[model samples]
Target: MSTLTKQDPFSRLLESAPTNFTAARILAKECYLAQGIPLAKAEEYKFTNVGKKLEQNITNFFNADSFEVSEELIKSSIFEGFKGDVLVFSNGKFLPAHSAKIKGIEVSVLSEKSDLALGSIAKPEKDPFAALNQASFENGIFISIPKKAQILKPILLLFFNQANEGQVIQPRVWIEAGDFAEVTFIEQSVSLGETAYFVNKVVELKGGINTQLHYYRLQNEGKPVLEVSNIESDIQKDARFTSVTISLSGDLVRNNLSFNLLGSNSEGNMYGIYLLNGKSHVDNHTNVDHTIPHAESHELYKGILADQSRGVFNGKIFVRQDAQKTNAFQQNNNILLSDDAIINTKPQLEIWADDVKCSHGCTVGQLDEEALFYLQARGIDKMQAKGLLLYAFAGEVLEKIQEESFRTYCDTLIQERLGSKF
Candidate 1:
């Protein structure tokens, strides 16, 4: 069965193009012009509408300048002084001057010939957004942690918008952790303006044998911006990788995440919570691929949609041949605050391995009326009663977060969304 009944015309252009350039600048421009912003008719883009938003010729307005960001702006968006190496990008350009170095990590801005040193990291061949990011990125941060090294502090990558005038920006990040390396990383994206613009960013991560990574992404871009992110992680044998995403703001947001278990005895976990209100739209699309034997993966995504907002969750797990003993489970649950609120959730599993255990499920409904009424009967007002019920709904996912600070931050965000003093 085909996901789409019709073929996409833009895909044809990519089929005819050459694949030699590392950045593929010209190819991306050609695709942008030929496709002229994809519509729902596009096969892979059936659920997204940014292609329609790009018709404003905003990409052409991007310009590179020797810009500098102020200290006040950095302090305003900083994520609690994480201990590991820190890389700061103001707008689209990397600011090495603002970055702090660590003893055991190698971090720098990517330029020509740097890819030679960043071994075994496969650059995408057909992803136009990846190509566009590579071509237009003023500077990209590249991190390499040596084998057997454990980072003491979480590496922070902060993307701050310093542009006085609103402009479209694309930033790229590439990371490689060697065998036996262990690290924790946190990425926070904050915009300064109420300007209307688009952000198409990509982050690629690679973990070698026996490696471990704890990754977290926090996005708070306000109401006028469109936030789109592509996060892909490749895990090797006997390795562990975890990704946590907490979505709180953005007029329209989409996160595409994928995890590949390429070696035996590898494990992966994907956890996310999104809070939506007003007329906002938040979508989370993810896939977990188990290709080797004795691999395991678990995914749970929960959302709180209020007002007339909409939320979407699509998760798929694939187990390939010879991937015996594969264990995978996926679940998506949501609480809709109003009759006007909407949620679309789909959980899927495709297994070619006969000796595996896999299951998936989803639920979309209002808060538990009994629980709300019980709280209300205990002297709680209608709004406060609903807030208590909704908070408990998302607390299951929040409890899994290991870092106390991150957990507390997410708690405060949830409280603010509920608009209750408690």
Candidate 2:
């Protein structure tokens, strides 16, 4: 995926006389050629050295003709208590046989005509990964909800990568919620084991007038995986869009999330929790654009780094000049347990409207010894008290989830990740 020079991997790919190239792919290729991959030195990607990783594993492109999915794998992929239509994708290609038949919503593939999906990807001329994904995306899902539809159940997108040959997996998803519609979507990326694999994922969210949509993503890839993902959203008038990302395990993971409040009175809420151990690395960069008046956006992200792992969080909230009376808030907090753990947190706010109220802050610290001691004084052991305090600290972000089962599952996972301190 290196866009460094004329002899980069993508250029080498072009020299191989690639065939069956779609118009979108051609455009993306041109964009990549115009603007190469952003190096680690680049200001935008300075914290995460994705360019270096790509340079090291440049030839691991997608080459599988097809794949086989075991029934046990499918069963294990879905949560035990989750009640929803599971949409399955194996190695970037959608599997209709394993996926449930979605009802009440229209689903299709993203083609050149799908502007709503393609437009959010932006010009690859500036974003190398966007160009790469647009050019290399194998299968993309376009989902549309009808007006006034109250979708009670959730739609789980289970992306399973079976990288036997160490291939590239790019997944793109576009969702459009109709006016006054309410729906929830869960996107979970998983791999069977550790391997030298690269997964590039992009998601587009559109909220219509008065629509309320909940978007949740869980990344549980194994240690041998490197993932780069982006999420773009558009919210309409009186609409409410909420997103939560729970990152558990990955060798190298970077998530770029952005949203635009196009209509007045629209609300956006973004939340994330990342638990990293071993030598894992996870970076979450988020931005919310307020283009309309009277809009509001709130964000909160927390990270727990253990062992020699590292985590980075950069959040931005922008209030346009015309966005008067806007209310925007952002926060990022990190907990470093081991002496070898590292965390970099930055919260940014850009306000051009004089009538708007905006605030941003970030905190990086270890567990409070006083709180642990307080819990220990109440008859709890030291290690157990620390675990309980850690759980309570992380629970501040998890408790906001509306779904009971999903929230419980996340809470349980966090507790398990806390493990035994002693």
- Against the unseen true structure, what C-alpha lDDT does each candidate score? 0.74, 0.80
- lDDT score for residue 121 of model 1: 30
Model 2 per-residue lDDT at 22: 55
lDDT of 2 by residue, 1-422 (tens): 34555566655444432333356567777887777777867777878888777667646454333378877888887776898888878787777777777788887655433445364434456467777777766566778899999999988888878675456777777788889999988887767656777887778787789999998888888887888887888899999999999999987899988888999999999999998899999999998999989999999998888999999998988888999999999999888999999998889988888998898998888999888888888888987887887777778788778876688778777787775343
Candidate 2: C-alpha lDDT: 0.80
Task: Name the candidate that leads on TM-score.
Answer: 2
Q: Per-residue lDDT tens digits of candidate 1, residues 300-358?
A: 99999889888889898999988999999899999888789988888889889999999
Residue pairs that clash (backbone atoms under 3 angstroms), model 1: none
Off by over 4 Å in 2: 1-6, 12-23, 63-66, 111-117, 121-126, 420-422
